[model samples]
Target: MLRYGILFLSILFASSFDVSAAAISAIQSDLAVLRLCNASSPVSLQAVNSVLINRDMKSSETQTQDFKCFLLCLYVEYGWMDREGGFSLHHIKLTLESSKLPEYRIKKLIYSCTATEITDPCERAFNFTECFWSHSDKETSPEAEIPEKEVSDNQNGFYYIN
Candidate 1:
C-alpha cells in the first residue's frame, strides 16, 4: 500500500506539471501579443494588468472610451480581427490556435462568439474578447491556468511568468 501511494502521487505530480507548463506557454504567447499592442501609445499598466489578470474590465474601465479602444487594439494586434469588426475563422483556427483546445471546439467558438450586433468597433471587439476569453477558459481545466506573477518596477515595464 505504501509503494502504491508513492507511485500514484508521483504520477499525479507529473501530469500536473505538464498541464502547468502548457498554461505557462499560453500566457507567454499572450504577453507577446500584448507587448505589441501596447507599443503604439501605451495602454496604462493598470488597464493592461486588469484585463490580463481579471479577464474583464471594471465597469468604469469599460465605460471609458480609451479603454474600450485599447481592447480593440489588442484584437487587431492578434490578427484574427478584421476591418468589419468580426473575427476571421481561418486566423482563429489556423493562425492563433489556442493551446489545449481541439479544432472542432475552436470552430464552434468562432461561430458562437463572432461579433454581430454591436455597432461600435470598440464595443464589438471588447464584447467578442470577453466572450472568447471566457469560452477559452471554460474549455481548459481551471488549474491549468497560472496567474500572472507579480513584479515591481523595472525599466522594461514587462512582467514575466517566472
Candidate 2:
C-alpha cells in the first residue's frame, strides 16, 4: 500500500540523517498519513527508487527532472503543497517534525526552498529540489550538491550534465 511505500521512503530519508531508531519509527507512523492521500500518478515506484538510490551520484538532466518531479508528486499527493505549487509552512513543519530532523536544518531547508513564487506545482517542486540539494551541507547530508558549474540548461528547460 501507499503507507508502506511512504514508510520505505521515510526510512530512506532517515537513513541519510543517521537518526535514532525511535525517530525512524516515528517517521514511519507520521508517513502513514500519506496513505490517505493520492498516490504519485506521474512517477512510478521504479523512478522513485532510481532517484533515491542514485541521488548522491552524478545524473543526467532527464534523471534530475524525473527525481524532482517525483518529489513534487509526493508533496501534491500529501497536500503539503497545493496544486499551484504553493508551499504550506505548517505542512512543511509537520513533515519535518515527523521526520525528526533538527530544527535548524529544517528551518534552513524551508528558507532555502520555499516555492511560493512558482505557479506550476511541477516546476516549483523541481526548483525546490535543486535549491535544497544545492544549499545542503554535503558532510551532513546524504545527497551531494550538483555542481553549479557543471549544470547547464538547454533551450527546452532541461539541464545538461557536463
Candidate 3:
C-alpha cells in the first residue's frame, strides 16, 4: 500500500510538470505564430525568422528583446505610432510577470493596439473567414455541438461505451 501511494504521488507530480510544460509551450508557439503573420515586413520578417531558424538561440536576453520587438511591431502595424524603437508612447502594457518570462519587458500592448482583450496568437491563423482580432467580441458556436434538449432526453446520453 505504501509503495502504491508513492507511485501514485510520483505520477501526479509528473503529470503536473507536463501540464506546466504544455502551458509554456503553448505560449511560446503563440508568439511564434504572431511572428509568422508579420513576416511580410522586412524588419519583422528578419527578427521573426531569426527566432524561428534558431530555437536554441532562445536565451533570457533574446526572449526579452524579441518580445519587446514584437510589441513594437504590433504597435506599428496597428498605426498606433508612425515609427519604431521608441516604445514608451504605446498605450498597451505587456509585462513579463510570470517566471516563464524571466527578463521582464513590460510595455502596453493590449490597449494601445486597440486590443481590448488578449488572445492566443497561435489560433489566429486557423480562422479562414476573417481576421480573428476584428471579431474579438463575437461568439462562435462549437462545430460539433449537441443541443442541451437532446442531452436531457436520454438517461445514459453522456456515456459512450463504444
Q: Number of the top candidate by TM-score? A: 1
lDDT: the better of candidates 2 and 3: 2
Sort by TM-score, top down from the best: 1, 2, 3
Ranking by lDDT: 1, 2, 3
For each of the candidates, give the backbone clash count. Answer: 0, 0, 7
Colliding residue pairs in candidate 3 = 92-108, 92-109, 92-112, 93-107, 93-108, 93-109, 94-107
Angstrom error at residue 10, model 2: 13
lDDT of 1: 0.58
Kindly report which residue stretches of model 1 are placed more than 4 angstroms away from their true locations once superposed.
Answer: 1-42, 95-98, 139-162
Superposed model 2: Cα runs more than 4 Å off: 1-46, 56-70, 136-162
What Cα-based lDDT does every candidate model obtain? Answer: 0.58, 0.57, 0.33
lDDT of 1 at 110: 65
Candidate 3, 1-162: lDDT as tens digits: 323333454457556775676766665555454544345222333333444444322344334433444544554443332232222222222222332322212212221222212232311111111222333334443342322211111231121111
